[model samples]
Target chain A: MQTVQTIITDLKDKPGALLPILHAVQNSLGYVPPEIVPTIAKALNLSRAEVHGVISFYHYFRDHAPGKKTVRICRAESCLAMGGKALESQIKTKLGIDYHETTEDGNYSLEAVYCLGNCACSPAIQIDNDVYGRVTAESFNEILTEQSA
Target chain B: MSITVYVPCDSSAVSLGANRVANAITQEAEKRGVEINVVRNGSRGMYWLEPMVEVATDNGRIAYGAVKTGDVASLFDANFLNGGTHALNLGLTEEIPYLKKQQRLTFARVGITDPVSVEDYVAHDGYRGLKNALSYSQAEIVKHVSDSGLRGRGGAAFPTGIKWNTVLNTPSEQKYIICNADEGDSGTFSDRMIMEGDPLVLIEGMTIAGLAVGATQGYIYLRIEYPHALEILNAAIANATAANYLGENIQGSGKTFHLEVRQGAGAYVCGEETALMESLEGKRGLVRFKPPLPAISGLFGKPTVVNNVISLASVPVILDKGGEFYRDFGMGRSRGTLPLQLAGNLKHAGLVELAFGATLREVLYDFGGGSATGKPIRAVQVGGPLGSYLPESQFDTPLDYEAFAAIWAVLGHGGIVAFDETVDMAQMAKYSMEFCVEESCGKCTPCRIGSTRGYEVMDEIVNKRDLDKNIPLLRSLCDTMLNGSLCAMGGMTPYPVLSALNHFPEDFGIKAA
Candidate 1:
């Protein structure tokens, strides 16, 4: 029930307020609602195209609703060296989804990230807020089970 | 007095199950009715033995690492509270060769102090640089950094002091200081470590930059990938502000500086300064042409100073110890310590903060201890995805900036990702192009088009569709991307592709041309 007005009211005065406002909207609503774009543009005095342009540019902001949990798998060099490629393939198979796609049950969404800044522990994956490292196929399932339980 | 047990709260360590181990230790302590004070510290950078639990005994902090949740009860059973013998005991934390040999100048407070505690930070000589800066003139502060020979640790290797000097001399009613914490590089994590471990140091450094350049407002443009770093940095900023070390009239110096953390929507190109500013302006993360550098016409079109986390973090130490003290550590123009992050198929993949003169062989064998898979290390990629893939023959090259440049490689961000013999260099080269295609801001056509073309050519080469024609075509495409591109995204993509071809052409189903 978080409205665009609530997100923009506090942020409109700050310099470069669009990003923070967009982040706030996405954070609360789980996605940047397309209908709210006109409202955001009006509040920030930006054109609808300008607001739409920004939302589409960055990969983090999603226009549509997301699955309950976003699964980001590391696709960077360090992780790739430590079996990240395999892990990526395994996770894709397990979840039955590719990058940017949500599961049919709306329980999971897969993403391909370059690096998680956890290079020391390669083959890292972030399930929502928690990042798991040295993640084998088995450990990945264990994590899901532990979380859902 | 309760016995103190230190557990890492570092994101990397947490990713490796440190949180579980911490919870287990707390529950085990409660079960045993042991009066223990568990302090969550940052990682010591020895990641292979992460979840490195430390106990403060009369001797010193003894280390036990790679600890699991199941190992907690046994640790208590063995009375590890007194630093007793345990199978996982790593003796004194300082005595470990991997950590002991590291001249941890910037990382001195990391893993040792409570991250969010300002008191702990001050006790570990954290704000000494800012305290020292308050006593000197702005010119003196800039001079200290210049004399230290500190370059942009975010891979550009641009002189930090020169950037500050430009901003300092620029006359502007409202100047800004932006810390580029958008660490998008594949094999690097030192910036993340600093932000997560000793965030105050970066805050102190940014404050010093603000003081040096007469900027009243500062913003850390951190990437969205690091949620833990975001939390830690926010907490540290709040804590620092509370201590009067960050806000108006900092430390009663009557000088005002306000700091804020701005999250970047996941765009790799935003790591570029101009794109970063563009992103900061709530626009697309597109690269802008130079001549009016960030110091000249930066964020909000005002005189601004943009610095990397490591370069900014290094400032506090440079100010604390005179420039000469830091300058004397490393060789040539690359003075002071470089916290080299060794990763990917390395047995001891961690942070090794050594001086400039160390060779790649020393880092790979002496520090890294060879491949994690027990295979001979074949190709090592330094810098990030843009860095060249060096062969074993070039391993003897010293880690100095000039030396790396002489070998057609870069010491970019001091991130070394090693690949074993089983790695297909052709695939890696292809991935580099793909990464460029994915990350390109699309401001320039060369990077955008050339990357896709590069991927197509590599696919042809990989599949042996037309090795002879496609190989030369790949070189031509690389040449176009190298010169035609607007920024490093296109310009440096050739490094990995060409280097992979030059060094491991056999993998591409062809001999070196």
Candidate 2:
């Protein structure tokens, strides 16, 4: 666990420190803990509402805990054109959880992204940072297998 | 004291191994005990002969192209440092036909200077706009921008000057300026290129926006996918801040402004203004109702000006050269150059910032050189995936906002994705609705529920089950979604589906005998 001082001291004086601190905390602890809000508020000379408002402003900041493995599917226009919807439905059925919902076994957290800009090979998904393009429903099973293992 | 070597850092150049080529030159120069200044610059956007490098000479910058890491030794032997020519021709970097033909006002410094160097930016007349803007009243600045005929480059052609004017008119204790860099459009990398190639211009543009609107705080909503761009921008912001270009009492003007970058999780809907604002507030990517347009009550319910990266980035030039000078380059209501992103199956996939009146044929044939696969170009999808698929007959169409809208299409983000004859329009059509269903924020009924049903109905048409009923159903569904959705995610969802249904009915089994 990172001390509140470490997080605040690391970014307090910077010009655009809010998002970076939020990203840093999330990277270190998987989520931006509510505990840091007060610390960030004090360190940046902001109110808790101000800090929390900044935290909640961007979509990337997560407050809840994530499952062990993350599965992100590209549902952007190009991906959808290439059978992404069917693939998404198949994945949900296989995982038995809808988007933004964690699996019962804590194995996966599924979410959809707009465009990965990997449209050259349509119907793409990002398993962590690695992009898999032209992916089908059949290829999705292998992703779960890796997570299951 | 300075020995200059150019590193062509354009996206196409990177795709064609310019990074490796640049690295090799760096390492070889180190080995030979040559004191060299390596500057990574933006692409000239003439992509066919990419990996194009430039070396500064007494006469002018000399150009070299199609260079690889392996070609470094020959380049060294050819005495490139002293301006000797190799097989990769050289006359003057400025005189290249493709580059020379372009009336580059917005992209004047692109591919010419080091993106990270403030010295290079200043040498190329950077910050002149900000400097000029500093002397003007906020209202005067906004008036100048309004007169320039600048509109939002993200998608909708909202007048930029009007937006700034609104934020200025709104009597708020706290106002905001946000640069929407969530460039989620496929086949479009102008946002990436501009950030990587000329970051200071964007900074300058944003600063001008901040100054124009009496806002002390600003945020750049950047996408997470652009890690490299984020890094470059963060560095530039830091340098600017240290030099007092950003943050408290900028350049001792007694006026204050602070800017920060907010990295977005990969959400497509977040590109929408309200959704972007919501995401910036750290909620689920959901669209907000308009009327209290972002100009009135945006970004924490303060008077906010949300402009796209290109729109904000174009401000400096509009200020420095005068709005009239910047406005003179484009045709009609579209009064400025657009950073056209030519991508997908095209032979020349790169950034081309040209005037609005340029025809599709000129871009596809004259600039893009047709299909990369060497197959006959069948159709092109201008604007991102949400744009309608225009057949060859529409090739005569010019790429202006009104011109494109007149033809039942939109040049969203100026991304042109070319497809060869091999592409199936039916599958593509199905994918469009399917895409909307997947990315829809579920905030509105038309987008969330209608898109899913539209997909099913589209599938029914292609599968030839109750074909007549389903075709009309899909059309009606598209119509409802278009009118009802809060944002274009649901609104523009109809473009691909409707275009496919209209143009390729045979593919949907209507004419298939």
Predicted model with the maximum lDDT: 1
- The DockQ-based CAPRI class assigned to model 1 is high
Model 2 ranges off by over 4 Å: A3-22, A29-149, B9-16
Per-candidate TM equals 0.99, 0.84
**Distance from true location, Cα of B448 in model 1, Å:** 1.2
In model 2, residue pairs whose N, Cα or C atoms come closer than 3 Å (at least 3 residues apart or on different chains), thus clashing, are: A56-B281, A56-B282, A57-B279, A57-B280, A57-B281, A57-B282, A58-B279, A58-B280, A58-B282, A81-B431
Docking quality category of candidate 2 according to DockQ thresholds: incorrect
lDDT of 2 at B460: 82
Fnat for every candidate: 0.84, 0.19
Candidate with the greatest DockQ versus the true structure: 1
Which is the leading candidate under TM-score?
1
- Please write out the lDDT profile of model 1 over residues B1-513, one tens digit for every residue: 899999999999998889989999999999989899999898899999998999999999999988999999999999999998999999999999998888989898899999999999999888999999999999999999999998888888899889999999999999999999999988999999888889999999999999999999999999999999999999999999999999999999999999999999999999999999999988889899897888888999999998899999999999999888889998988899999999998999999999889999999998899999999999999999899999999999999999999988999988999999989999999999999989999989999999999988888888988887999999999999999999999999999999999999899898666
lDDT for model 2, please. 0.79
TM-score of chain A of each: 0.97, 0.91
Writing each residue's lDDT as its tens digit, candidate 2 over B1-513 gives 657988776544664567788899989888888888888888777665678888888988888877878889888888888778799865688887667766676678888877777878899999999988999999888878988898899888799998898899898999999999999887677787788788889989988998898998889998886666777788888888888888888888887878888888666788899888887765567798888888999988899999888898899998997888877877889988888877666776666778889999998888778877788877788888789888888999998999999989998888887777776777778878887776788889999998899888878877889987887788889899999988899888899778877777777878733
- Taking all chains together, the TM-score of candidate 2 against the true structure is 0.84
